[model samples]
Target: MTASQPTPASAATLDAQDPLRHFRERFHLPPGPDGQPSVYLCGNSLGLLPKAARAAVEQEFAAWERLGVEGHFHEPSMWMHYHETLAAATARLVGARPLEVVVMNNLTTNLHLLLISFYRPTVTRYKVLMEGGAFPSDQYALESQVRLHGLAPEEAIVELVPRPGEHTLRTEDIEAKIRELGASLATIILGGVNYYTGQAFDMAAITKAGHAVGATVGFDLAHAAGNLELHLHDWDVDFACWCTYKYLNSGPGGTSGVYVHERFANRPDLPRLAGWWGHDPSERFQMKKGFRPMPGAAGWQLSNAQIFPMAIHRAALALVDEAGGMAALRRKSEQLTGYLEALLRGLNLPATMLEIITPADPAARGCQLSVLVHRNGRALFEHLAQQGIIADWREPNVIRLAPVPLYNSFQDVQRAGAAIENWVAQAE
Candidate 1:
């Protein structure tokens, strides 16, 4: 890769040829001072709301207003089984059968619950292996789970840190540790795609390696779910959890989902925190004495679900399904993100001043590029935000720019590059 003139018009041509361009109109992008739509590239943090989400939420509101408590089951939206409506679509997106999926609580909460079942620590094998720089919330959950098991947090929770002076963890390094610790590993809970570096780990390979030594494998797919193509069931993942707000475009704090493999599909007898929702739908109203887990992932549910957020997820997933699912999204994502990488490399910026930590291979990453700016990083990021090129910045350093397949375009990438160039010039 070498520096060359960034022809914005050629980038614009790429945007015009994009098949997913029409989907951008379905969103309401923020407007700038010139009253033009903003170039939103921060879909990795929170996604733009689909216009359909508005109607879906309003329908639920209207149904509640008209039917009152009757809305629970009698309303037009039929809240009784509202979650089920989104299950199949969400399942299809994650490559799981309807029975293998569950639309449940938020990400961390679900992670804790899944840990309760999967993290069965024992005398000989009782440790959770994860990436060192995992999201704070996940690390906190791991610490708490370790403490709850009556073990020292530091000993029970082992973070597979990157090699010295390296920013990203490598696949070979991870497998080496797994091979060494897999026998004594109770559960292997890793992020599907790293949140900070935008590195997508090989889920199938990771799962297979972990299972070879009798370890329960799971993933916190907050970064991978809709952003990357995943076959959770096929990978034989013990469990997985994700929020729908990022690439799924379901809005902030939108409904989350989980996957339990078909191996556990019919084992309704598995120990879990059972609520009325997990009881047999047929005998649910009977106030059953014994807990009968639903045939699949739904068996993990507890109590009533969030209907409004679930409806938004339903509308958002329809867009995902219509866009030809994760396979198609991933295809465009590779070229589109590669275009951004190409443009970034074309800049004559100094390596000492700026760095792209994301992997060059599309198979090893999603659409995110974690850019590290050595000079005035935060200010430069704020400047880009003021320019309406939405991207997320973590404290200290790192800006995650995600060119989402659904709405983001090549023009957005070019606009971002131009803004960063201007920032560099100003600093100079």
Candidate 2:
């Protein structure tokens, strides 16, 4: 029920013993007024820039300067097959086969593309089931997709929400809803981790339940990709898409990744909107007539690789891989987040002041802890921001702080706690 409240010395001790402590030096941290690195805990919203990203980008710039029109093939990292280079690392990140994954367009774009292929609505099976309070972009995309199919958004989409007073959805409730929707469920798409409450859903369980109802299953891994340990293939997830900007640390508007289960990968008969890049590479340049789709998830590509962003993405993923992949990072993440929660609990603020909306069980969440600031939430958020503690505030009243395993230290978490304690004392 209680942890040994983290002290300055204890935080230092944890940092000293941390195997991934060296990783903190690999990112470019924004400095506070005193010129010290600010306590950054906003990774769930946007990750800090990796130190290697600049140099990787510069290398590509140099290739472009020298080769001009020939750079597509002559560059060292060869732009022609650049997406392929990212395939393995990305597949490893989400626990999928290389062919099942492809680094391509942004998150929402890929989601629409995947929907075009997967959301096959019929007279009987024409409804989608998703978690309520999903990210706004996902909500808009789902609505638009439904409307495009000559269906009303309200009727074609079903959203699962928590019980009256609860903050997060229960797995049993989700499965029960899926079973209830059985024959009419066309596809099930939900955030692998809910962005609002920081609740990491039971993805494998959800996938199983959706499949049992004869519904296609997919996930938006925006909050899950680099924050949680995902096994998409083993979970039998049909398809998935995620942006690289957030937990993946690939900068804002970074290239995204998509996964199509291998069973669908080899099937060209699957209906999808196509483009020249998605065509087979063999006769791709021959000015082909009919669209001969490439095998695997790459078949969904609509444009050339966004080379600049992909370069930074490569730099960021290298850090994840070097840290012994997601398994090791997740181990550190649990401890770091637990430390943050302990520090917050030790504050002993009034229940009206701050309440953690995220699931209390570590297994049900990722690195983020979404705290509901009941009163003066915005003022408190501003205070923390001015104090050089970088966290994010959501509309109405939630403050999200993510102690990223790759860069954030226990001391950073300590400073953030101290800032909160100081602010709450002054306010109350």
Candidate 3:
């Protein structure tokens, strides 16, 4: 069907038939200006709170209250091994083996830890390649990492920018760049989904290209983990890290997830920053002088689990499992995003005023559709807020709207479209 053909009645019909529509009630949607639920299309920034999260957190509090320090070994849940509970579900979410995944520190911290082992640089093969506009945290981490190795950031870091006037990078161009960097490319790291443009890269192809050139391949899945159907193990990703607060619906500053390929599971030769918790549990209590790391991704843990955030994470992951995993979510995500695209395009706004910068091909993007506003951009964003359409506005020009399948309804998309249309009408 054409972008202009979907009407409000059609939207209702589609919502009614949606198998996942009932999942919307599982979240707590923020109220709009009218004191009703807002059209929340901003999961790309921060997801709505899962209704189950409160009970999960209370369970942890109750355990601590009853057992004190002994809660580390108590029933119902054990603080010492709490992170283990998340490993299997997280593995399934990202298509990795349970042994290869762990829930631990915040995103950038995990990235730095993974890079310590993966981004080993030699005098000749010292350059790192990444997408030009990576999220600021990734950029900062890379720059500081290179300096730690006593290499100049300018000489050791390479960023790939799109061709003239392009909003996103092409897969072929990325592959070409990898080949161009060749043996000098010590590591390849990019956001699995570009945060600004909402472009999802071909990770398997990218991993293959990086390995072909003797480079370690990793991804900052901060925007991709819960938003995309990932297969990190099949793709041979060396390492990856992501925050759980966005699409995963964990609370703000939720603990991050890490994946270290199983090949590194027992590679004690790999250099890493170790802590007491990461020590082999059998020997951990012995308080030995040497750090004998545990096998698998669990070995990357620097401290014991962050109980409060992890409680919420466990709760959020249950919702994903109950919804039949990412395969089911991805199917609905494509349709929900497509419906929003249709509604926006149907407005027929002048290109000078509004532009959908996100890739049109569903396979090349996530649920986010980045709208670039040329004139009165902030005004338009304010109009959206006033009209009860919650979206994310990037500095300068872009506004990002994500119709998350787990909670957002088709009616939310209709309201967003109407809000933008009203803004245009008033401006005219």
Candidate 4:
């Protein structure tokens, strides 16, 4: 039941037999300046760079140097519609039709773009429903959008708080709030996965509940898009957005994607910021003053894609697809994260002193484990970092360790757990 019994070398033997073990070789993992590998458990913050990403990006750069203007149409990967090329793979990752997805700007920017279209609010129904402790960027975006609608954020937004002493939100409480908010609800935008806690919400059920009350439902899928199983189209989610830099392994500030259901396709009435890229391919060069929005999510594009970022994103996604997409990844994620949880529980650590804020159910979360450091959380995290265990630290007491199934092995999780226990012992 415990991981401590296994010799560290046994982990290498286990990794040798792992079906997805070869994936680690595809990434150029972080190394100390001295060229030693850093124990990277921070895929939720920034993913390790895929070797293919480097190669793919280099092809584009090489083309640019040799072909100049010809790179747009003659390049191996066309920049003229670069983001379009990525749509197919992204759609598969998020469970949407290819036409329903488009790779474009960064995460926060994409969220703001989606909000402009979906967050229509009338005086009677101007409330934005969200979890109380959403990522600061999400909270800021919602508040700014509310103010743009000519209402005070305090009056226009409704945040759902967990009851006293609870770390996670209850589904029943969320549904009750939707029922109670009733007519005042304009849009429901939520994190598809809670960032700090790594909790994956029930997208289908929430979408259904929101639609029942005439609210348009959307999600910011920063943590869930690739780390968890998603069917945004099947869930009937109106729209969703996520960055590729995290679980997608596309490196920092990599291209992000947005999903607009097929129902919204060709619906010219939907508000969107415009550019030549969103214009019809042939007509884009027509230089006609009138705008002609393309069909599906491509119409939401504001500018041509970033070729290097899109190339990197494509390379990373190929790794996910090669591993048999989310189906295989999710199955392994359950086991890997479950194994980590088991190791933590075996430490016999008191729940009062340390805690896992993430949901216990595999159905409700992804591969990341968000641990609350009971005492001297920041110092403990610093100590772990010094030990070459790279996890992300949030204010207060949270340290998020995501053992990405695509590249991380059970051995990595075991070492991370051991590091945490050792750090705790040192503190004592």
lDDT of 4 at 216: 95
lDDT of each prediction vs. the true structure? 0.86, 0.93, 0.93, 0.86
Q: 1 or 3, which is superior by lDDT?
A: 3
lDDT of 1 by residue, 1-428 (tens): 22224578777677677787898888878786467888888888898989999999899999988998789888578888887887888788888888889898899988988888889899999988999989998999999988888999888888888888778888888888889996688899999999999999998988989998899999999999889988888888889999989988888888789998888878865667788998889999998598888888888888788988888888889998888899888888887788788877877688789889898888899999999888788998899978887788997888889999888877788898888888887888
lDDT of 4 by residue, 178-271 (tens): 9999888999999989998888888898898899999999999999978988999999999999988899988787888999999999888888
- List candidate 2 stretches off by more than 4 Å: 1-4
Task: List all candidate RMSDs to the true structure.
Answer: 2.1, 1.5, 1.3, 2.0
Model 1 TM-score? Answer: 0.96
With a 3 Å backbone cut-off (N, CA, C), the pairs that clash in candidate 3 are none
Total backbone collisions, model 4: 0
lDDT of 2 by residue, 187-279 (tens): 999999999999999999999999998999999999999999999999999999999999999999898999999989778889999998999
lDDT of 4 at 202: 86
The count of backbone overlaps in candidate 1 is 0
Look at candidate 1 and give me any clashing residue pairs: none
Poorly placed runs, candidate 4 (over 4 Å): 1-14, 32-35
Using Cα atoms with residue i matched to residue i, what is each candidate's TM-score against the true structure?
Answer: 0.96, 0.98, 0.98, 0.96
Give the clashing pairs for model 2.
Answer: none
